[model samples]
Each structure stands twice: as C-alpha cells, then as structure tokens.
Target: MSVSNSPNSIPCLLLAAGRGERMRPLTDELPKPLLTIKNKSLLAWHLEALSAADVENVVINHAWLGNKIEEALGNGSQFDLNITYSPEISALETAGGIRKALPLLNPSDYFLVINGDVFSPNLPLQGLLDQVSALRSMPNQPLAHLLMVPNPNQHPEGDFYLKDSKVTNEPLDGAEKLTFSGIGLYHQELFKDLELNVPSKLAPLLRVAMAKNRVSGEKYAGPWHDVGTPQRLQELNAAHE
Candidate 1:
C-alpha cells in the first residue's frame, strides 16, 4: 500500500512501565529504557526515532524508578519532542497502560503505540498511516492496525498469523508464523465502548477485531528486536554497536 509523502503529525505512546524482571540489577539502579546504549539511553534513541519521523507529542508511562526517568528527560524539549508522563502506582500491562495514557493521546485521531524496551530499524511510519487510512475507509472499521514481522530466532512459532493483510489469532495450517513487531497504529475507536479504570489486555480486543476482519497488518521484513532479557539486550547492543 502506498502512503502519502507528506509527514503526518501523529503522536506516539511509548510503554515504559515494565519492571524489567529479567534485567534486574541493571534495572535496579535505572529503568530499562534508561540503560545506556552507545552512551545514549534507550529512551533517548526512541525519542530520536520519533522525532525523525516528525512525531511531536509522546506519552510515556512509568512505574519502576519512574521519577528518575521524568527527571532525566523533562518535557522532551531537548529531543524536539514534547513528552508527557503517565505515572502509575502499579505497573499496568500494555492495554491498561495505554488506557491510562489515553488522556495524553490524540483526542480524536489515530496515534502510534510502541513497546519502549524493544528496538527496531527505522520504522515505516507512512506505511502504518496507510493501513489506518485503509481501515477507516471501510464501513464499521477496526480500531487498530499492527506492524508484524517474520518469526525471529527466539520465537519461531510466532504470536499471530497474517493472511490477506488481516490478523488472526487462530494458528494457520502450514502458515508462516509471524510475530508482532511491538509497533502499531491505533484509532481511538478501539476503546470507544471500553469502560474507564478497568484493566484490559490489548490482544483479546485485537483478536475480536480480527475475527470481524477489521484489524489489518503488513509484514515488515526489517531488523527488529524484542530485548526482553539481559542476554538478548547484550547481544543486540554488541551486534548493533
């Protein structure tokens, strides 16, 4: 799908509320997003990526060492991005965290969401926008569009299947499994009828949309890493550096 060349002012929500259980000691002193990679914090790198894509506003949710993260990157003016924090007493899972940050997101427009701990090659933001547009064009469209990637070494079976640009929770027969790339474009409609203050998992909500052929996706054949473990982070840092 072709996307418009003009840069869009899409806002981004970065999920930084994890406890980093696998990155214990390192995270004991600092949040995983604050870990130095080539003298730059992972959070900083993500901000730079967003800025390069012309994304201006960013909502970051935090819990572990949350205050320190806010102190380190105040208002995000330094990165040419406006930053807002959603402080949570208890770390909410992806869906819950996003719901908590909804107040900071675009009130009536589609926005971007990504896992804060993972790293990926320069994202095709335009392609994501195209998917959102396509979904909105259809009658009674879905609320989200995901960016998927071919199965990585760690997750060979993958998390979900993609066929004909639609997502499915059901395992496909002899289908090439693909993993979610931790990056997505989402419309506010996904949470339209959701009650506030209730914890939710994004997967089930997405699956519902997929069942109706509302959720859309595109396979991204690019460098992607889900740095969920210390060993994996070390390997990625070494290889990328």
Candidate 2:
C-alpha cells in the first residue's frame, strides 16, 4: 500500500516501555498494548491511525512482555508500515525511552509520539502539521507542539495550562485546566540538549522549552480514552463495543 504524500508523513515513536502497573493482572499475561479492546490490541488501533495519517515508519520501544509484542506485530509490514523496535533491558521512562529511540526517528522533521495505553479517535494530523509549519516559519520559535485535552474524570486536577495555544507548567489557579492528551508533535531539536542515555522525564523538557514560550498546543475536543486501569479498560471495551 502506497502511503499518501503529505508533509506530515513523519515517523512515529510509540512509547510502550511502561510496566503497566495500573493494569496489573491483565498485564501479567500480556503487555498493555497487546490487551484486547473491541477485538483489537491497543497498539493495533494506534498503528491503524498512524497508517491512515500517512505515517509510514514507527519506532516501538518495549520492555515488559516485550517479546510478545514483537512476536505479534513483527516488522509492521502486515499493516504496510515499517517498524523498528527499541528494546530496553528495563522500562525507561517516557523521555528516556524517546531518547533511546532517537536514532530510529528522523532527526529532520517533526514526529508524532503517543502513549501506548491511551486511545483517541483519528488525530488531527494536518492541523498539527500546519502548527509545525507555522512555527518553523518563525525565527527562534517553538520546537514542540502538544495536543491538549479537557481534564478527564481520572485526572480532575489536569496536567498543563493552555493559554493562547501555548502550554505551561504552571498550575492553573481557579481557572480551566487541561490535560496533556498524551499525544504530541515534536521536533528533533527538542532533545538536542539531553546527552545520550540520560534518564529524564518529558515534563522537565517541556518546562524549559515552555518557559521560553517555545511550546505550542492545540485543544482536542474529540473521543479520547485513557485505558490505564482494568476498570477503565472494561469501560473502554463496553463503550467502543
């Protein structure tokens, strides 16, 4: 299958290295991404979405029950996608996992990154590309763009504050707060400062960049599900079914 020609035909980084401590027993048998929801693995849904968006290549970082994921998906050719696995001895946190897979990702264009457990409807890839293009057009501009969503029931306090489509680390004091939808388009240069193999979290990276007003975000008012706990997984299964 030929991928549609698009400026956002960038590769993706699927962060699947977490232990899925919240999804316990089910995770004991399979990785969270492999847990079935509506007769499809969580990772499968993500792959389909990426394929639809004209994304041709993906880098999957796996740890817990990692072999099962690889054995199931193989090289992604089944989906007409090329997949490269970044296997870690132990689960590296988000920023560290991304840093580990940096070599697999293109160091030129902006790439999409998403958590393995969260599920959202087809993302607004074109809209985000427009944001990236707009930012790149400006001199000394933002290098990261995030998809911000309304605070979900599980996280009422929210994650980040969005003002003028820009994300900030500062907590919202009696204001509408939104969560960082676990999806983002990031430029390769965003990780330039971090030395190779350094353990880190994505928040600090966003904070420094955001303080410089170099982080932009767009609110997504669409169907989004964070299947973190078994209860939530059941809810997602029932809802989607």
Candidate 3:
C-alpha cells in the first residue's frame, strides 16, 4: 500500500522538549535534538528522511534552548517541509507534549511520533505508514502501532513483549520481548481523553491500551541507538565515520 503524497496527510510530531539532564554540559547550551551525529543534527536527519517519504508537515515541540531549535530549522523550507513549533516553558512529558501539540497537528485521525533523541538510520516509515493506512478499514482499529527493536545493552530488561503483533506489558512464556523504538503511529482517540497541559507519561497510557489489545508492534533488527549519553553519541559518530 503506497502512502499518499498529500501534504499533512500523515503529520509527524518530533518529541524534542526533554531537559537532557544526562547529556549534561553539552546540553547546557544546546538542546539534545540539535546535538550532531556525523556532522548532522539528530533532528535534521529525521526531517530529511521524513521529507523524502513525502511527509510534509512536522510539529516539533521544544522547551530547553527551544529558540535555538527554531533558529536552526525555521519553517523547514530547506527540507521541503512545513515545520510548526509548539513551544513549552518546561519539558512536558511525552503524553503532555503530544496533547499540547494536537491543535497544530491538523487533527488527523492518526499521526506519527518519533523521539528526537534516538537514532535509527533504517526506520521503515513507509511500511509503517502503509500499515496504518490499511488499519483504517479495520472494525477494531488499534490505537497505536509501535516499532520495536531488540533490547540495546543499556536497556537489557526491555519494555514490552510482542506476540502475534500485539504489545503487552506482561511477559508471555517463551516469547521474545523487544524494547519500544520510540517511533510509532498513534490514533488521536488514544490521547483524546487526557487532561491537557498536565505532565503525563506516555508509558502508562500505552500500557492501559495494551491491556485492551489496542496496541500493536513489530520488531526491527536494524541500526538503532538510544543516544542518551555523551559517550554513546561519540560512539555513534565514530561508527558512522
């Protein structure tokens, strides 16, 4: 199933408002999303790929050093994309950030969300888009379809288990578990009930949906890195070079 090229047909929200406390002095002056990997800012890589996939409208929410993010990306013309900024005075956890950006998202039934800090060079955006497009015909549409990856060394315990494409917080005997890759296709209904402007974590919401079998996921065994620390950034840069 080919995705439509229409502008904003499938809008994406880049979660970039974290404080980056672990990234320390480096983030003291620069927001983590603007941190460079192989000479390109992390968020820049996302914008480039998203544009290539014909996803034109992107909402980037920023808090710390957000002015720099705006100064760096402007209206996203260079990337052939329309960028909208959702500014936050302080970091609003994942769910809160998405809720606040709802108005700017064009009120799509479903939208894509990607964590600004993670790096996945081969993220299959088109495939995920196609899946979501197909789901529109289902009677019991899933609230979200996440991209899961093999647990990285930093997170050995993993987050959720996947069986028959369904995501669950509970462990299934003999089932291989994977970590959430921080990339997903989400239906607006999943977030419609949340209290706006309040700090709320996304995990709890996902877990609740999972219990009802409303969340689906797929494991991606590709180049992926959760660039949470300075050392990891250095390693990713060196590996790419």
RMSD in angstroms, all models? 3.5, 1.9, 2.4
Answer with 1 or 3, whichever has the higher lDDT: 3
Q: Give the C-alpha lDDT of model 2.
A: 0.83
Per-residue lDDT tens digits for candidate 1, residues 65-87, read 99989999999989888899998
Q: Where is model 2 poorest over a 10-residue stretch in terms of lDDT? A: 168-177
Q: What would the TM-score be for candidate 3 when compared with the true structure?
A: 0.95
Report clash pairs, candidate 3.
none
Writing each residue's lDDT as its tens digit, candidate 3 over 1-241 gives 2345554368999999999999998999999999998899999999988887888789999999999999999999999889999998888899999999999997559899999999988677777777866667678788889999999999999999998788899988766789999999899999988888888899999999998988888888989899999999999999999
Off by over 4 Å in 2: 171-175
Candidate 3: how large is its RMSD?
2.4
Q: For model 2, name the residue pairs that clash.
A: none
Q: TM-scores of all models? A: 0.90, 0.93, 0.95
- Using TM-score as the measure, the top candidate is 3
Better structure of 2 and 3 per TM-score: 3
